[model samples]
Target: MRAYETRRGARLSAALMLALAVGACGGSTEKAEGEKPHAAAADYERGPHRGRMLRDGDFALEITLYEEGPAPLFRLYAYQNDKPLDPKGVQVNIALTRLGPKVDRFTFAPEADYLTSPAIVHEPHSFDVAVSAARAGRTHKWTYASYEGRTTITAEAARAGGVTTERAGSAMLGETLPLNGRIEITPEGKSDVVARYPGRVVSMGVELGERVRRGQVLARVESSESLQTYSVTAPISGVIVEKNVTVGGITGGQPMLVIADPTQLHAEFFLYPRDAERVRVGQPVEVTSLAGDHRLASRIEAILPTADLTNQTLVAHVPLSGPTETWRPGLGVKGTVSVGANAAPLAVRTKAIQPFRDFEVVYAKVGNTYEVRMLEIGRRTPEWTEVLGGLEPGTEYVVDGAFLIRADIEKSGASHDH
Candidate 1:
């Protein structure tokens, strides 16, 4: 079936070619320089010019300055052979203009021996590209230009914010290891808070977003079955963290008055099983809350057993010794747990990592460019992922809008093909 299809296509192509040839003979032609014009039917005897048609395919060419050191070299594929001309002996016309004025012409020594099949050409040509600067007192300006067929304006007057690029040399490939999470003081351990047991709240003593102290009567409840009155008191002596029981609502053994020791707050985070192995009980953990600009230096207090059933996460509890004013529960934060191993990995913000199917991806900042790197994730918590491979420590990657940066890099690489 495939061979039959191929033959059918070839026959169709041959018919189209014959029709084009006949139509070209019927078209008008321009007389040569100083030649007498032929009659309408007499010009049909002259066939198509091979020079113009052969220049249509494409030329893989590179242009560089002969003397200007460190100046950028422009690489382009001039689509010249558009007129059905054979490129075997076609002339190549190159002109250079600076600041919209003609400066020089480059005539490449054409060789038919360098041609390849499928009409693709790879050639490098260098010439002295210099523009005479107009010196006005202490200031002067210069320009650069190139042309293939028509006069193409390559550059314009000097200005900032133009297309500037550079080639990067050898670079270090570092592995990115994600941190556990932002340390947060668990709300349960803080103030003198208590839960109302099997009772319906009849009234509330405190309003929402209000502060209550230890032993404070925050609400009143009644037994759901027996109608026995009960007063919901603060369990621990701290500010009210939450008021779970609403007035006139029945709560069965639920926490109604949430109180904590405001001054004794600590951060709790989760690590993956792989990362949990690196953390010790006494290792220092640098805690930073997203709710504020402050950071607290704390230590890993415990590595809890049993994975969190909902997430399969290994929990790491860190106690903060700093002032508790900056730390709060339910606020998103992040911190790094110092792994005592000799091989410390690079850390990146958790927001920058994107999950794809079963793996994770992060945008790594390579010099001034960003690249999409597939991460070998060993462990992950709410705020960080442990990088088993594919990143380095201390290197800054795009934490904000990393996916956007990756998209832009891919788009830029695709545009270079043109």
Candidate 2:
């Protein structure tokens, strides 16, 4: 429903709650003529089956509402002097007064165990109800209102409960392109320490995992043919990620050390062919842990023209611009690429969202009164949601602690209209 309609209905429901309380306590309209209003208070009781009981001496009428079908059903069972009263010739009329001055009338016909309404009742079950019944040459009429699942709290109380409100403002919501990626060592960041020729090992200069500088000797080998010792130097400044030579082992063409700089790593992501065209150099991307807890900022550096033969997905390489320790080769990550963005003139914090009845709603603070407004959401994210309708841009809403209000409304028995 629209905001105006729901707000109006909610306000009417509140009024109905007050009216029901007062009228239910005053008993039925069958009071003796000229009887004082306070002569005998209504002694209505809630029956074991959760039905409403209307009693007068030995005559009782139990009313139960069924909502498991397409419409609201009002079921009534009558008794005379504590015995089943045949309702074959009885007549009943029920009028439901709703907001906007709209009223609906329902007639009743005797069914197997009770009298059922002739037509299905419409919603916003919150309303002022008047029932008139005629049976055995006697007429009876009564009126009461219903306001279930509604609550009201002062602004001061809301504030004390840690609730805060803010008006939504315009923002740019990104069209995220999510991809799975892994940190990798770029060709520029890796180097192999070679023996340069066949030789017998003489000395070891560096150990596995040792940090080394360019041109630093990682091992010294004696050439078997020349019987001369030569040093194997690191081709790049990096940690010795691999080592194959020992102090006394002979080596030939084999790498003595494999050096790689973790800080100079790049991330590779695979995207579908369609997603590849939208990715451009320098497009910002957020890198998150596989668990989506930590984040690092990066940008696309290159887009490979080739597609993976197995997955038929294009590859994109990104350069990390944040702390290097947070990313390492062989680690998987989630990358959100900003492929598109839109301007949202009206929006709200996602934290304020809650499920109310059959709709998603946010509690809007209207002056001293808080109204529950249903929302039509457009673009949404973990932090913000764009408002398509149901709320104005300048309207202040409960951005935090909204669950407290939801609990209060349910406590009022106002949400069980169904």
Q: Which prediction has the highest lDDT against the true structure?
A: 2
Model 2 misplaced stretches (Cα beyond 4 Å) = 1-150, 153-162, 168-171, 196-198, 213-215, 223-227, 248-254, 305-307, 321-325, 344-346, 410-414
Cα misplacement distance, residue 193 of candidate 2 (Å):
1.5
lDDT of 1 by residue, 86-112 (tens): 334433333443222224443443334
Q: Clashes in model 2: which pairs?
A: 148-413, 148-414, 149-413, 149-414, 149-415
RMSD of each: 18.6, 9.2
Q: Candidate 1 has what TM-score? A: 0.35
Worst 10 residues of 2 by lDDT: 18-27
- TM-score, model 2 to reference: 0.63
Each candidate: what lDDT? Answer: 0.42, 0.68
TM-score of each prediction: 0.35, 0.63
The clash count for each model shown is 38, 5
User: For model 1, what is the error of residue 318's alpha carbon versus the real structure, in angstroms, after optimal superposition?
Assistant: 0.9
Clashes of 2: 5
Local error of candidate 2 at 101, Å?
15
